[model samples]
Target chain A: MVVNSSAELTDDEVDRIFRALADATRRDIVRRTLAGEASVSELAGAYSMSFAAVQKHVAVLEGAGLVTKRPRGRERVVRGNPDAIRRAQRLLDAYEQIWVARIGRLDALLDDTPPQQ
Target chain B: MVVNSSAELTDDEVDRIFRALADATRRDIVRRTLAGEASVSELAGAYSMSFAAVQKHVAVLEGAGLVTKRPRGRERVVRGNPDAIRRAQRLLDAYEQIWVARIGRLDALLDDTPPQQ
Candidate 1:
């Protein structure tokens, strides 16, 4: 019944993931967290924006499953989720395949025809 | 000078590609065109929206390099471009690699430590 079993996240899921990634601030958060888990304050310090803005970005990333927050003492540390990124990559790969198949069909059609005047 | 040579579209390029893909109508346009080249009217017939709206979506796809419009008599036939899709896929692949490397570092850190009580 399911068309794609691998990384077949629903459109809603893709929307959430992509929307979260749409912002440069959130992207920077993902990139920084990828280096290692960091507390909210630590991430806030790197940006010129308000701490609340950075917090909101982190929340968006968490909602998209791109980042996971764990409690450490009084702080919460956020870590990047590789599986989620892999799922997003798989979706893009599917789109790539669709285009490839289209090209293949055109090639077949061209091959079937004789030299044109 | 370039950080990523593999499908390394600039931020502006990514913004355009993702913005073009952000719409459901444009996504449908890409999907339909992937099946085969279609005239604007033919593509318009499948959707409830106006032909002009469909044409706009087609234009967006063309701008994103996802579709190529070729003149055929009075009608322009739109064909999908596999190379652009591949380029986009490579960008997503690079993001996936970033997350994977992040996880690898975490695993390495954990391996260095003994079981905690």
Candidate 2:
């Protein structure tokens, strides 16, 4: 699925991505799937949870665009989507820029420098 | 306050940070405060919402370690915390690595390469 658009993401999209990532198990699933596509059963075998639970986690990752699943011979092979991750990184980077600018202002104030006119 | 802990953050802490960032208004508040420290009243004046609402947003940001508030005269001046943002970036970077590794494995498989022995 096309996860990226030129416009910024909505709040809900960001919420979904972060929420999907909040769980350590889901994060591990993403990590494993990124290495290569794997069947739901294959992934379930590695986890301590039931197959249903792993499937649900995969669904959450899929919804967040973090993982994409394709049917293959009565099984669904899941793959991680790197572009979605890059987009998330971009969002964090923007916030970092804002944060750095704020720190710079504080430094100037502490140094008793006049505002640039 | 020291936001960084050598230990990894707990699930609840991650929840608080993401929840605080889920609102556009709160995100904008972070952006503005990052530019420079500002009194609650000064920030509230810029938004159409009630002062209480803005105050609550500041509280959430502060809880997330995204912003820090210090008393100044009879007011509190809020400043953005860049280190928190950096830590968050680190988390996302780790995810990106996992996603990339998964993709590499898939690519190798697609080329009909045998499993690395």
Instruction: Report the number of the highest-DockQ candidate.
Output: 2
Off by over 4 Å in 1: A1-7, A106-117, B1-7, B106-117
* Full-model lDDT for every candidate: 0.76, 0.80
Q: Indicate the docking level reached by candidate 1.
A: acceptable
Kindly state the number of residue pairs that clash in model 2. 4
State TM-scores per candidate: 0.77, 0.75
| Candidate 1 chain B lDDT trough over 10 residues, lowest sum | B1-10
- Candidate 1 — which pairs collide? none
- How well does model 2 score by local distance difference test? 0.80
Flag regions of model 2 displaced more than 4 Å.
A5-7, A44-53, A102-117, B5-7, B46-50, B102-117
- Candidate 2 structure quality by residue, lDDT tens digits, B35-76: 767899999998999999999999988988888999999999
Worst 10 residues of 2 chain A by lDDT: A1-10
Q: How close is candidate 2 to the true structure, as a TM-score?
A: 0.75
Best by lDDT: 2
* Two-chain DockQ for each candidate model: 0.44, 0.50
